[model samples]
Target: MIIKTPTSHTFVTGSSEGYTPLNAFDGALLAAGIGNTNLVKMSSIVPPGTREVPITELVLPPGALVPVAYAAMESDIPGSMICAAVAAAWPTDPAKPGLIMEYHAHGHREDAESVVRRMAEEGMRKRGWEVKTLKSMAIDHRVEKIGAAFAAVVLWDL
Candidate 1:
């Protein structure tokens, strides 16, 4: 018997404001173009030789169980800021699995993205892998009443 693995991945980011924290999170997920599906949170590893795609190119059945590594932030204080980011670091050797890093905080998009990027780099370095490519996405939200920011690296089987 053979075991199949995810063949492709994508990065997505989104932000939204709502009357409640849960609603804000839902809005963020919708904005990220993944609101309807069930998300299966996975650990931080990109399969060896996985291809990268845009989120718009992903066509999964409605309510399908999707695997993802994600970061999310929510704020209820009016005018407070939140940011979320996710990064992927692929190794120079395509046969080696890569790393995924997620970060969320009360900050700006740049800060959040930078942090996750560094995290990805550090993770690859620790594993003695030279990074071949780095990809990241981030979102920032300013809370009116309740707001959320979300970022993810979604994976799927071919």
Candidate 2:
């Protein structure tokens, strides 16, 4: 499912049998009516290829963190630092504050490592996270057919 500002687009390619008439709009209306959605619920589903993954599969436990990692954009393009932007709730002493969460995207752009470094520094020094760690190594996939692929990190913190 690809969700734009207001409309959500879903794509389905069934086996030779073809797909049934599934209406994403109707489903969205139902979801809205049921009061099951919030602002971030807009892009609630996984991207095209990651559908089979389980929701709890990538969760990082408290006191644990993922490292910096990279994926090949296809060998021609240079690699970039990537951040797994996440909304997190810091554990409060009494939970009195409830869930204090914030939205942040981390990582360095392919050509701008300095910018990434600065952002990382800011996040670590002032972003309220209890921990920060480089999660994964970089991989360059600069194949011609893939075009000039942007530097990106695929895995995410949910």
Candidate 3:
């Protein structure tokens, strides 16, 4: 069997409040523009030569199977904050593969984004790869009476 790799990827973030935890999560996914697709969670590897595109550029079938690296956080406590972030670090050499990092916390978007950015940088450093570009997205949700969800993802078509 031959294995195929993704040709491109995009970063997206979303947050929402809902009547239930699951509903909140679903809302977050919809806000991220991926709720209609089936998600396949993958590890942190950005294939070499993969192009980065805007999320709006993606055109997939309603039930397409999407591959992603993601982070999510949920809270039901009123006034509580939740955050999710994802970062991708590419090497200076375009032919080299890159790294992706996901982070979630009970705090603000900046904090979560910072953590994941550092994580991605460290991942590249550990691999002795020179960093060229770092891209990240983060979402923060303030919970109300019911629940709230925050999510960030590096999404790609298979």
Candidate 4:
């Protein structure tokens, strides 16, 4: 297999409802503008020198394999809430790779968001790196029948 290091990254979050759990997940992906692409779930690591991009400036072709660190939650219980979130902490040292953290739970967006952000900070702390910049995104859904929430830090190249 070939390995490619991404050049840039972006954050995305989306919530959706559907008839089934998988459908709800798909809808959430679609709502996040990342549907139709293969999401290759990757571990939390932002390569050194990589920069952040606006979600609108990033695009993926259908059927392409995309690398991401993500959190996802799905629930079928009506009126239940689900939240997903992700955070990226860039190290103050440009030579060091940054860290990414993901979290999902049956809770409000604020709860999930806070957890993921702290996770990022803890990861950087473990590495003895100080965060130069921190970025995050989160989404929550209220289930009617089936619902899903998804958040991700997409790593990509031009």
TM-score of each: 0.95, 0.24, 0.92, 0.96
The models' CA-based lDDT, in order, is 0.90, 0.24, 0.82, 0.91
lDDT of 1 at 82: 94
Task: List clashing residue pairs in candidate 4.
Answer: none
- lDDT (Cα, tens digit) per residue for candidate 2, span 22-139: 2322232232221122212322222222222222243434333222122112112223222212221222232211111112122333323333334444544464534323211121
Give one digit per residue, the lDDT tens place, for model 3 in 55-127: 7888857987778888988788899888898999999998888888999989988998899999999999999
Residues 49-117 of candidate 4: C-alpha lDDT, one tens digit per residue: 987888889978898899988999999899999999999999899989989999999999999989999
Give the per-residue Cα lDDT of candidate 1 at 125: 93
Off by over 4 Å in 3: 1-3
lDDT tens per residue, model 1, 1-158? 12458999988888888878889999999999999989989899988988888888898678988888999999988888899999999999988998999999998999999999999999999999899999888989888999999999998876
* TM-score of candidate 4 on Cα atoms, chains taken together: 0.96
Rank by TM-score, descending?
4, 1, 3, 2
Off by over 4 Å in 4: none
User: Which 10-residue window in model 2 sums to the lowest lDDT?
Assistant: 12-21
Q: Give the TM-score of candidate 3.
A: 0.92
